[model samples]
Target: MSSAFGATEKSTRQVSTLRRFLRYVRPYRKQVPIALLCVLIGAASQAVGPFFIGWSIDNLIAQGNLQGLLLALLALTTIYVLGIQAIREQIVRVGWIVQHVLAQLRQDIFTKVQSLPLSYFDRSEAGDLMSRLLNDVSTVNQAFGQTIAQMLGNLFSLIGIIIAMLSINLQLGLVSNFVVPLMILTTALFSRWARSRFRVTRKTIGELSTKLEEDIGSVREAQAFNRVQLNIDEFDQLNAANRDANIEAVAITAAFLPSIDFLNTLATAGVLAYGGYLAVSGQATVGVVTAFLIYVQQFFRPIQILSQFYTQAQSALAGLERIFSLLDEPSQLNDAPNAIEMPPIQGEVKFQNVAFGYTPNQRVLNQVNLLAKPGQTIALVGATGAGKSTIINLILRFYDVTEGAVLIDGIDVRSVTQASLRRQIGIVLQDTVLFSGTVAENIAFGRPDATHAEIESAAQIANVHELITTLPKGYSTYLGERGAMLSQGQRQLISIARAVLIQPRILILDEATSSIDTRTEALVQDAIARLLQNRTSFVIAHRLSTVTQADQVLVVQGGQIVEHGTHQELLDQQGIYANLYALQLGSTTPVNTAP
Candidate 1:
């Protein structure tokens, strides 16, 4: 959780972050000028109202100029009504523009997330990314919709009042502004503190969201292990931290507004005392003194509003910092500058002296070499984390090799666009993933434009067409998240159907049948045999029975291929493969050592 905050350290590109944010406002360029005009009109109108009131007090009330007073009152009422309407119009237009800007921002963030490398996801939590997408983006929206307009409007109002005050009486105007410096000082100090606290609050909220998502997704596991109370205690601790951070932020805000109010009170008193002295000395009229008092109040009101906007502005900037930080992360995998689109492949894959590690100085695959001629089955058998999956990752170019190259038809995978390289390969993992959609849609995922006949054909080839017919809506039936509504075997069959639809030149089955029952395995095996008929295939299996017919079996251990031969040939060698095969069959006979 602390690491999450550490990751959001104030970026050096803060100015660029703001510049990019302003670019979002560019689309609303025409509307913005009109909106700001409305704001200006509203501020000027409000500033003139106090003059009309003072004129009526001095002329109509004191000198009994009834007609003049009625004219002044009418003018004040009209100005007040127009000002309200102008501000309302500004709000409506700004709201529309703000909504569009937020929509565009969210779309950009989502697209960037898609382009990021797999390693980024391996190190990031889904909840944290989602928080940025939802919560942080919404905060930025507030900056545009509420904070920006308020800041601008109040700024115009502040300027208008200052000018009106100075025009009426120079002495009182100068006195009224005595508190301006004090207010600025107060705001500067509090805002600095508030910004730091609000950043922590936002980061804490993200961490809490991440924890909640993780715990809820694994609730069943927690219950099975009887760790429910422990989970609750942990959540309570995070909740308390979030609450404390928020309270501290509130405390800073709580101190800020009142300090402004207190200064405002002192300034108002100064205006009254000075203006009364002027009225007594005949240096200023009663009406002018009264109007100056009203103008003073008007002056501080915007300052007060501006102070509050400052807090919201800080929060929005914090969110912007986080969002831009994410956008700044360069993808670990990228094609070379001169890379070309991979031509349609014949599926001859070779790993020549390949080596890799997720981190420096820690190799996961070491000096590995292997070859799969066109339309051949290469079986990789090893214990978990013995580099079986790493080989598949290299074949798909998910990660670049630390040394040497992976080639398809003698062209380095790194020299081809990833999309083009991956388009020719199909993969089915041990855990099949199906999105929330109709059975037909899942099968057609790799080819959305695939016709009904093509979809059914793929399903029939995977041996799941009969199962689809049994569903209430056949191919149109809705499968819930990850296809939870279907049996595991049914889901695996659908995944295979998806791969079959792609008609990929190279196919990878990583422990594809390890979790199914013997009956389902037999059915899947038959489908796989048909699917592998003419495609280059890589089969990784814990169940050696699945790899018995492979054209070549590579026994991998500790990031190296210890043996490579036909299944019968490896059994004759009586090495690791022979021992592993015997153990799976519940045989205890000691096999002869290859050494």
Candidate 2:
């Protein structure tokens, strides 16, 4: 009884998940009809071929006429040629239709994921999301591209064969028909077992893919920690499970087929024996008996095909459910119904009692209030997870504040279009990200229409022009993945250059120089000085030295602003800011230059 309850629970979960997935197919309804039409035409061509064979055998031989034989050969040749051409055209058309539909499904899933609130990414793993977009989507396409049309065509052909059989001889047809129920029962049982196995097989594939993505993305860290064998063992466990699941499904399917073939053979023997009895008794002709044999062969051929189709259909449906589940997730945040565009103006930013958290019922930033006017620099300093970065996030509206208002030029950010608000800001992150493009292209990413002269000017301001010009292809050289070809400092410089080219009203520099050496830091600092001119800026850094020139520096602790003052002012007060500055100074310089 407990086992039955557990099974019911598992089935409920699977059904719920599958229903969520079918939403992805909703957009491609029009394409489905066209694909089915092609399948119908293909099936007609297939069914007609066997009849043409029977006609040549029966009509030409029974009459002993050369003219009838010649005409049958000509008809067979015509059907063969035209059928091949029609089927080929339909196959190609279906391929094109599947590509477009799959592309649309992928695009929708990706766009929806992007629009989801920051909390979604906080709770989700990068590897899992990647698997949904790539592996799961590919599985859905395989089912649609290969399995669906074949299933439909086989279904139609099976029905046509059944009708043809009954018309030839009722008793022979009844004997052949007996196997149909058994075949269906066998298919249902095998498919039920295979479906469960395929579901597990696909899930194992996802887990393996997720593990590979995480390990490869952090391969350097894994190597540093000497966990290479550990990752391999984890991967082996998943791959082994996947192999077992697929093998189990194949074994279950193989077990059903031999029984089906035996039944088919027995049905064929019954037809031959019974038809011979009728023929010798003068109740049936030789030609009728021959045709009945052909019909019996036709009957089970489509049944074999139907069984194969049913197995694949189960797998395809499972894949579709996974893909659609991703598509159905609603975004956590969206634009307000009457949201207005942020107007161009002098840079002014304000946070009024702002509070936020990645999850509900827990606040990471509480009642945090601050203001930054045009050309002013505000620096935030705190211990790790003290909501220093949270302040910057609220300012950028990456996640909306739960308690108070975040304003840009006195306009509520949430009431304005996100695009307009983001356009006014330029960010240079701690870990600089560069695409697979030339130095000029990376620098001018924010403003793609920027000319070569404009790109070089920004690069010069970021102090990267000389370094870029030294490359073999100058500004046109292609960067490798994530700009691995360049040093850490060079990538930071490129990020800065990209930001500067936009000429944004506000700038964000998050530990922008933390990854560089002292010499490169000095160069980056010079570029920072040039870029921050006449721009409102918010900077976060572990090194207190970077905030010395700021107009206002705030010490954050426990999600609140504990201290706010100028560098010298905070030093004199000797509060949290003073201790942090002293700690950074003690760490950055050696005691007495040698101790």
Candidate 3:
């Protein structure tokens, strides 16, 4: 009983998946019936050819009648012409529909990818996502364009031949159909096995692709660590698995086709033997016997083609399952139904008794509360993983607080659309990221419509205008992937320039100058100071000296604020903040301790 329930449940899920896939074809509904009609007409035309040949041999040739022969020949020519025309029409119409469907599917997949939360990317492989978008979509396209029409046409042809044969000679027709049940049984069993194997092949291919993408992206690290052989061995294992999966699928197909052909051959022999006997005993006319022989062969031809289509359909369905699985991933973050556009304000941000975690059991921030008034510079200093970044993430609503609220200007951050909220905030990270584009484009990324004068002015404010002007093409100079052509400091300068161009009401410099040399750090720090002018700013830095001038310095420890005061006040207390400051500045003098 349990097994039966499981099987029923599995079948129901498959039906649901199929129904979802058919929704993509809903828009092309009008064209579909027309395409199927063309297929049916083409099959009928093809089925008539064998009967005409038989008629010519028996009624015309056997009678030695010139008029009958001439008439039969003309009829045969007309049938061939109609059959070719129908087949051509079917191909043209189905091809257009398949291309249109693929385009729509790809567009939808891309849109879904963009709408998904950043957390989705954190846990998923880029290559696997790409495989679903490109490789799997192409597989479905092949099945729709080629296999669908062929399968329908073959079904119609099989039916037409069976009917024509029975009308001509019932005994021969019965003999011709003896192996069809066996063919059906063989196909059903083989297709089940093939579908399972093809699914494995597709999964293995995705895994292999994921491995390749990971290895290629980190090839430099592998070389630096002298782990080239290790990576190669790992790649070989994945490659071997992909090969074995493909071989298993191919083996099933290899065995399936010939089995159908053998059954067809057996059916043909049975028809010829029975028809010949009937003809000899004068129970059937020569033309009837002749037509049965031709019709029997024609009947099994479609069965063979249909078997092939079934195999292709299995592969295509496997691909469709993966593609749809990707599309079905729920967006973890979505705007509220009545979410309002964030209004420009003084940027007075506050975290009110907020508690949060990336997962349910592992709380990363606990009852955190803080406030940043308009135009105030708040510096967060903490050991790594001490919830410094989590505060920033909450402010940006990258992840919502599990309890309590994060408010900006007395309004809940979640109450506003993410785009409008983020648009008003500017961030420059420790690791600078720039797309492949002109120097001007990277700086104008946030405000694409900024004029050349505004772009140059922003660059000048970031102290990178002279450097950019020295490049080969000045503002038009191309930056390669992630701005590989520029030094680390240069990239950071451009990032600051980008933030300045936005003219944001809130600014976050997350270890923005930590990795630069003293000279570059001075320039970046000066630029950051200018950018923070009259805007609420949060500075996360390891260097205590950077925060000495901040309006308020927060020393975070174990996801809680251990000390909070102005820089000199915290140092005067000689607590965690003083120790960190003393260590960084190499101060060893004993100081008075205060609570």
Candidate 4:
């Protein structure tokens, strides 16, 4: 009883996924019935063509009537021509529909990926997620682009052939089709086995794609460390696993397909033997026997194709399962039903006894409280893994607080729409990210409607105006692959210019100058200083220069604020902040605190 219940549940899930998939095709509903009609008409023509042969042989040939034979030939040709056209129409129409459905699915998947929480990406591989977007969706495309139309045509043809056979001679047909039950049983058993195997293949292929993307992205590191051989061996394991999965799928097909052919051969022998017996005993005619032979061969062909379609459907369904799984991933951070758009910011930011953790068992920030009135810069200085970044994440509402609240201008951050909140905040990270576009466009990323003159003004404010003018195309110059053409300082300038153009009320510079040389750091610092003016700002950095003049400095340790004061006041106390300041300035003071 338990097994039966499990099977029923499994069947229900498969149906659910299929129904979900069909919704993508529902927009093209009008075209679908037309395609199916073409399939039906094609099958009818294919099924009827055989009867003419039997009629011609019986009435025309046996009676030596040349005119009737010629007319039968003409009729048969016309029937087949119609079948050919209908089949072609169905293929073209369905292919168009499949491409469009796959396109929509991919667009929706990408949109979902963007809305997913940072925590989801924290635990998942970029490569694996990309595989669902490209590889898995492509699998569904390959399967359904050709399979659906052809599968329907084969099914209709099979049904028509069975009817024609039974109407011709019920007893002979019944005897000949004795292997039909065995064919179904064989197809069913093999398809059931193949479904799980193909599912494994889908996963293994995705894993392989993940490894490929990771290795390719880090090829420079591998070569720098002389670990190319190590990477090769690791990649080989994933590659071998993918190969074996596919080989098993091919092996199943090899074994299963031949069994269909073997059954068809057996059925043919039975039909020829019994039909001959009936003809000799005057229970059937010579032409009837001839047509039975033709129909018998034609019958197994559709069965074989349908069996092949079933196996392919298993693979397509597996791909669909993966795609749907991605689509079904919850956006753990969504707006409240009562959420309202955030008003224009005065940027009096506050973290009120906030507590948060990526997981429930581990808290990264505990009872963290802070306030920054509009237009003050707060520097968060801490050791690595010391909850400094978690506070910043809360400010951006990247993750909702596990407890307490974050507010902007006394309004709860979660109570406002995320888009509205984020638009008013600007971020520049240690590694500057720029898309492949003009220097002007990178700066105007947050404000796509910004005029070219406005872009130049922002660049001038960030002290990058001269650099842009020096580039071959000035502001129109293309920045390729995260602005690879630019130096580290240049990238930061572009990033700062982006922040400047937005004029965000709250600005975050997260180690924004960490990677540059002293000279470049100075330029980035100068740009950051200008960008930070007249905003409630948060700065997290490993360097002291960015923090030395902060209006307020908070020393974080063990997920709690150990000290908070102005830079000189913290230095005067000689506490955790003093020790960090001493270490970075090349002194030998040490401090320890409770975890």
Candidate 5:
């Protein structure tokens, strides 16, 4: 009894939430009215059949009228077939419109996800986002497609049946209605508890999905580290939690259903007893009593439907909450009102006294300044986490500097459109990402309209044309996701080729050759030379060989440029760059004068 009492209290809260959830359906009011009209017609057909039977029993049989009986049977058959067809057509059409509306909603969600900045991704969990995109959207789809129409239609049917029953005989109708309010009150109370349990189930399912994705993606790592059992245990725990939540939700519904069924039986018993008394007293006709019985049955059919709708609506409410939450999230960053398209760039890059951090009070770059004149190649060398990548990110406007300015062509980068800025720059990163497509497709990703000849030329300049030809399909070979079908060195070469194919005014090489063998690196040196010619470039690498080729080398320490000069000039100074050079060279060599 205590457990049942607690369940009732919890169910009350769920009913309130479900009521709030219905607000999302307000925009579809016009279609809803037509659909309801169809439902009402269908429900009216149910009561119509009972009247025909009553007429046959009380009049047709007494008069021995064979023609009237045949006509009534034919009419009943026609109404059943035609009404069912009409109802089906309306239901299917409503479903089609709802599906179309859902597609637009899904596209809106995906667009919002893409438009958000990097910081949003940095702070958000991949699994949580996936839940909203996949699970939540699906939940809402089911809700809109089925629940909304049924809820309103069942409600109207229930009301119509009650009115028809009273018109037949008021005392019997009143007796049948006695248990309805009780059933409704019980359901209203239990629904709140059921919804909370369902919400827990939904949340658990999302966590499980996220964990499964992570585990599969890192199966090798898990096995190698002997953590597979640990992961399995965690998954089992989540699965168990999800199971309990679902069972609890099912239990609430199961218990309430039996109580409602008992109440309905009690109503039917009262109608039978009272109608029989009225019949004996000659106060009501036997035909009227018979029709009233059918009406009572019809009345409860919609009640049962309403009970099921309550369960479905609860699940939909949970989905709506998650969907709205995702839509409510603020974008990582937005353009200023005065932001304008950047002018044609000459690729003169400047960072003046820049300070930045991924989060507040944790500086990554502090008081950092650098300059690259048009057609100059600057190399930045540092230990890991010395802010080399942060500088590149700032330059590309993947992130903005916390203080000061990043200027391109003497204009502040923040003052211009990021898309315009990026179109003029090309990047090759250490972890090369290639989409699943032919070599030509990957090379043309940055410039989708590039000619076939242009793609071959870029591959040739990158010195990978010969290797690509060696493959069975040459440039047409389909690379797997992230170019997993190719070797790391081969993927890096493709990335470099892609960058060169873009032919941007500015190029960024952030350890572009870090994954390749020395032979391939040496072979690609000329390609790098051709790629850098007359283009402003920032190259981040620890390899002394690559650093020495730069017009200027900047040795960054603790987010500041501690030393800056040509290779020989820096070696003469015997500072951070010289020490780093000697460390890689294994022995210090005499500094040679610049050419």
Candidate 6:
């Protein structure tokens, strides 16, 4: 009873998956009926082909009626021509519907992922997501585009053939169907046996794809660390697993496919033996027996096609499951219904008893309180994971505060739409990211409408103007993937240019000058000094020297501000800030980041 219930549950899940797939199909439903109509027309044409042949055999051949035989032959040929045209139309219509659904699915996946909070990406794998978008989607395309259309046409043909056979000779048609139950039982057993193997094949494919993406993305690290052999061994292990899974899946198919053909042969033999006896006994005409043979062939052909389609459906359903799973991920950053756009800023920022955590019931920041007046520079000095970054995150509203409010000019950050809140802020991080675009394009990323002259001016302020102009094609030079053509400091320079072009009321620099050498740092720092004028700024740094000149310095330790004041005031207090500065002065290297 449990086994039966398990089978029923599996069957129910499959039905549910197909129904979900059809929801995507519903938008293109107009095209579906056209394809189905074509299938029915094609089935009708095929159903009568055998009848025409029997008519020609009985009247024209037996009686030697040449003119009647010619007419029957011509009619049969015309019906066949129409059948072929209808089948062609079915394929064309179904193709359009599948392509459109796939396109919409891809678009929705991309838009959904982009809207989701960073927390989702922090736990997800990029390679797996890419596999779903590219490899899995392609699998669905093949099954929907061809296998579904063929399966539909075969179903219609099977029904039409069964009806046509019974109309001509009842007893013979009944006998020809004797082997059908056995065929169905064989199909069910083999399909059940192969189902697990097919699942393994899909899982292995996803793993292999993820491994490949991981290797390619980190090829530089692999080479640098001299772990090429280790990588190869790891990849080979995954590759071998994938190979074994596919082989096992194909082995199931290899065993099952021929058994279906064997059943078909048995059915055909039964028809021939029974029909021959009927013909010899004068219970049926030779032509009638011949027609029954054709009908029997048509009936079994659908059974065979259905078995093949089952395998394709398994693959397509797996793909659909993954695609829908991505779509179901909530955009945790969505704006509230009553969210208002933030107005231009006066740059005052206040954190009131703020508390936060990446996970529930675990606080990363606790009882944090601070205030920065307009145009003031606030520096956060701490060791790695001291909640300095988390403080910045709260101000940006990347994640909402748990205990209190983070406000800009007395307006809670969460009360404003995220787009409007982020627009008036400029940030430059230590690790810069540049897209595949020209030099000018990267500079004007924050302000797309900025003209070429404005881009050049920003680049000049960032001290990267001469460097970009010297590159081939100047502003029009295409940067390859992630700006691979540029050096590290150069990319940092471009990022600074982007932040500079925005003219934001507030500025954030997260170790922004860390990548540049001493010479470039002097130039970039001067430009940054100019940019910071009349703007509220937050600077996070590991090196104590970086924050020494700030208007106010807050020393963070263990998710709380251990000390707060000007650099000299904190030193006079002889607390954590003073001790850290004394230690930094004694040590040769800067403090490190969180692991």
- Global CA lDDT computed for model 4: 0.89
Question: Which residue ranges in model 3 land beyond 4 Å of their true spot?
Answer: 1-10, 586-595
Among all windows of 10 consecutive residues in model 6, the one with the lowest summed lDDT is 586-595
Quick one: how many clashes does candidate 3 have?
0
Ranking by TM-score: 4, 1, 6, 3, 2, 5
Between candidates 1 and 3, the one scoring higher on lDDT is 1
TM-score against native, each model: 0.96, 0.90, 0.94, 0.97, 0.89, 0.95
> Residues 4-42, candidate 1, lDDT per residue (tens digit)?
464344333445677888898897899988999999988
How good is model 2 by TM-score?
A: 0.90
Whole-structure CA lDDT of model 6: 0.86
Overall local distance difference test of candidate 1: 0.88
Q: Given candidate 4, what's the lDDT at residue 396?
A: 90
lDDT of 2 by residue, 212-263 (tens): 8888898999899999999889889888988998899788878877877888
Q: How does candidate 3 score on lDDT? A: 0.87
Report the lDDT tens digits of candidate 6 across residue range 80-140: 9999999889878878888898898889888887888888988988878888888778878
Please give the lDDT score for candidate 2: 0.80
Per model, state how many residue pairs clash.
0, 0, 0, 0, 5, 0
Give the per-residue Cα lDDT of candidate 4 at 224.
Answer: 100
RMSD of each: 3.0, 4.1, 2.3, 1.8, 4.4, 2.9
Report the error of model 5 at residue 62, Å.
5.5
lDDT of 5 by residue, 1-595 (tens): 9988877765565466555545444677677677767877766666576766776767776688989988878998987776576567567756866776677667767888987778888877677778878887788777767765665556766777777777767888898799877986898778777778778978987888888878988899999999999999999999899899889988998987888778878888887899889989998878877877777787777788788777777777787667766777886456677999888789899899999999998998999888899999999998999999899999988888899999888899888888888888999988889999998999999999999899999999888899899987999999978788888888888888999898889999999888788888875677888999999999999787887878889888898888898989998887777777877888756434334
